[model samples]
Target: MLLTVKIGKKTEKLKLNRKEKILKILKKLGLNRENVVCKLNGKIVTEEEYVGTKDKLEIIIIVSGD
Candidate 1:
């Protein structure tokens, strides 16, 4: 399955397995899984959220102020 990622102002396309999670995709993309957060369809998501082609995913990377 392919998931679309909206990080900041850039949108990137990712191809992953249907069972893959946002964290896996993030890691594949060289994103720090500990620092990045994910949201799917405008809702906050956990690491267990299933990634499917039917889902239009939104991934957000959280930055620490300190």
Candidate 2:
């Protein structure tokens, strides 16, 4: 399954063999789950959310300020 991922300003096309957790997907992309938010098909989803092929995933980086 091929998943389309958009992180910040970059877009990536990932090939996945099966459904997996959002956290694992983040790790595959060398991303920290704690520092980003996952959105599936325009809907906010948790790290535990299962994603598969033909899914549109958006990774939003969390920013902090003093």
Candidate 3:
């Protein structure tokens, strides 16, 4: 299964197993799940959300300002 992940100006295509969680996919990409906001198919989704083969994921990094 291939999932499209778009982060800022960069986009990546990842090969994932069936029913893989968003968190696991982030881990595979070496990204911290806690610092990123995930949106699946234009809707915000939780880390526990399972991604399908044709799903499109938009990842936005959450930044904290002091």
Candidate 4:
């Protein structure tokens, strides 16, 4: 299974043998789950969400300023 992930101006195709949690994917990409919001197919999803092949995932980084 291949998942399409978009992060900012970069995109990547991740191969997975089976359905996995979004948190795992974030970790694989060296992103902290706490700092990113995972959106699956235009809907907001949590780290526990399971994603499979052909799913479009957007990882939006949350920005904070003083």
Candidate 5:
């Protein structure tokens, strides 16, 4: 399946296993799981939701600025 991912300031299309979790995508991007939030469509999702095949996902890294 194909998923649209939003990372940093860009949106890109990625082909993922239908049941792949957000962590898999994050791992691909070299992002630490604790440092990012994963959203599907518009709602915040738990790891389980990402584990479900229904995740049409987008990810945004929450950064702290000084």
Candidate 6:
């Protein structure tokens, strides 16, 4: 299965198995799941959400400032 992930100005295509969760994919990509907000098909989703084969994912890295 192919999952499309967009992070800021960059976009990535990732290969995931059936029933794969968002958190696992992030780990594979070397991203910190705790610091990123995930959206699936335009809706905000948790890391435990299951990803479909053709799901489009958007990853937003949260930035904090003083």
Judging by lDDT against the true structure, name the best candidate. Answer: 2
After superposing candidate 1 on the true structure, give the runs of residues whose Cα lies further than 4 Å from its correct spot. none
Question: lDDT tens digits, residues 1-66, model 3?
Answer: 677889866999988768788888889888898899999999998989988878888989888888
TM-score for each model: 0.77, 0.90, 0.86, 0.90, 0.74, 0.86
Where in model 3 is the C-alpha error above 4 Å? none
- Model 4, 1-66: lDDT tens digits are 678899977999999999989999999999998899999989998989999886888999988877
- Please list the residue runs of candidate 6 whose C-alpha ends up more than 4 Å from where it truly belongs after superposition: none
Clash totals, every prediction: 0, 0, 0, 0, 0, 0
Q: After superposition, how far is residue 48 of candidate 3 from its true place, in Å?
A: 0.4
Q: What is the Cα-based lDDT of residue 22 in candidate 4?
A: 94
Instruction: Say which prediction, candidate 1 or candidate 5, comes out ahead on TM-score.
Output: 1
Q: In model 3, which residue pairs have backbone atoms overlapping below 3 Å?
A: none
lDDT of 2 at 11: 93
Model 1 / residue 15 / CA error / Å: 1.7
lDDT of 6 by residue, 1-66 (tens): 677789866998887668688898889889998799999999999999988777888989998767
Which 10-residue window of candidate 6 scores lowest in summed lDDT? Answer: 12-21
Which runs of model 4 end up more than 4 angstroms from their true locations?
none
lDDT of 1 by residue, 1-66 (tens): 566778867898888665677777777878876776778887888856777776766766786798
CA lDDT scores, all candidates in order: 0.74, 0.90, 0.87, 0.90, 0.73, 0.86
